[model samples]
Target: MAVHPLSALLSGLVLAASAAHANGDAPAGGEPAAAAQVAGLWCGDGLLHEFSLRLNQDGEQVEGELLRKGRVRSIEGRIDGQVLRTQSTKVGALVLEKQGEELRVTGGDGPIALARGTSFRRSPGATCAS
Candidate 1:
């Protein structure tokens, strides 16, 4: 089987996740905290379904990639404050709302309720770390 770019990208992102996780829930040095955690991959679970997202922040804008099962392409989004809005290339847009240790992305036909518990892991060569 041929290796997919997103697969490697996903793996790399997981590594980033682990490093970025701040168990303390707060940043030291009195540095300003970001509204959204834009430093790695995130996985959202729902019964048999799952979603993965990676946010690469450059300055004030965030470049993101969304991966869904059965689909090779990924959705894209931007972040500002505690909200993340990604525009689907095919249909609708998803909104990711981050509140403390919890996060939720809403869209699709069903209810837009998602739970947060840091499903994303750190990859092999990650640059984002605490």
Candidate 2:
């Protein structure tokens, strides 16, 4: 069964949120606060599943892997203000923005099932485990 990259990507969103709460990073709202830096682990819980993403930032360049169901996809991009724009040779391109404590999907290329505005939380101390 071939899994769509977008589907796998969105799945990680749910897990990121779960990890955040477990780490005691969540506020009363049950969501963790967003970090100023893009370099770290992020998780998101989608309507259907969970997923994780790990990012490393150096200056303006950002590189990371999005993980779901033991599969990993490499992505690279740049940051401008609160927005992170990333591209993957296998998964295509995606754009995310930090809004308060959530990293929301703002845009993307190609036909994607992951909706724009789908959000993920910063998973501090969370590792991108397969």
Candidate 3:
């Protein structure tokens, strides 16, 4: 049997996070990093565009891949309090906050530019295909 590349990557990430936690290097906040609600696959649709975010959160640090307008880009950021802030050369900066079952893009500049209030839903079974 063969393991998917993404699965392998995520597994490695989980291991690293566990090791860090065991070493007393948890996130700055009082809450456990494993409690992060943004660590999952999310998707959103707009009037003219669709995007998907495959995020992995390890403590305050976040690493993920973003799919927007059929283009894919790797993104890295940190969780500041309740917001996840990510930056990419192609997309500038993106600030996301979890609201109930949605992850809303509170502020940011993407190539296609989503509105400030645009929200994404957790879609773990969804693909990045646009």
Candidate 4:
């Protein structure tokens, strides 16, 4: 299958964030930790579609892959305060408000509530790659 362009972009963003973190270039404050808290695999099941997202967050930057109906799209965004704002080629702009462990996604046709997928693993050794 041909790789999606958005996937490449998101992957680059993740790599850049990792490099910045490694270089100690990440902004100082609680933002990094706060963003880190949002890093995980999240899933939402609807009557018509099942949505899954695997996110890696460092500082205010977020990179992830969203899967719905067997189609994978890359997500790139930033967190400001308690809201995570992201955009994808397929979904356009998406706003997710953090409420406890759930992310209420909006800015789409309809809203979706995504819960942390505790049983989902991004890799064999990594629970959710960061």
Q: Which candidate is the best by lDDT?
A: 3
Rank the candidate models, highest lDDT first.
3, 2, 4, 1
Question: lDDT: which is higher, 1 or 2?
Answer: 2
lDDT of 1 by residue, 25-80 (tens): 23454344565765565554443136556667665466666556545445556665
Which segments of candidate 1 are over 4 A away from where they belong?
1-35, 107-130
Extract clashing residue pairs from model 1. 14-121, 14-122, 14-123, 15-122, 15-123, 18-122
Query: Whose lDDT is higher: candidate 1's or candidate 3's?
Result: 3
Selected candidate, larger lDDT, 3 vs 4 = 3
TM-scores, one per candidate: 0.47, 0.63, 0.62, 0.52
Tens digit of per-residue lDDT, candidate 4, span 20-114 = 77765564441353452568777653332366678888889999988776688888888865678786454355777676666665444224323
After superposition, the stretches of candidate 2 with alpha carbons farther than 4 Å from their true spots are: 1-36, 111-113, 127-130
RMSD of 1: 19.8
lDDT of model 3 at residue 128? Answer: 36
How high is the lDDT of residue 87 in model 4?
Answer: 62
- Judged by lDDT relative to the true structure, which candidate is superior, 2 or 4? 2
What is the clash count of model 2?
Answer: 10
Of candidates 4 and 2, the better by TM-score: 2
lDDT, each prediction:
0.53, 0.72, 0.74, 0.62
Off by over 4 Å in 4: 1-36, 45-49, 108-130
Q: Give lDDT tens digits, candidate 2, residues 1-130.
A: 9999999888897788778777756754875444347778788657413677788998778999877777888889887657788875655677888776677888887543255768777775655323
Clashes of 4: 0
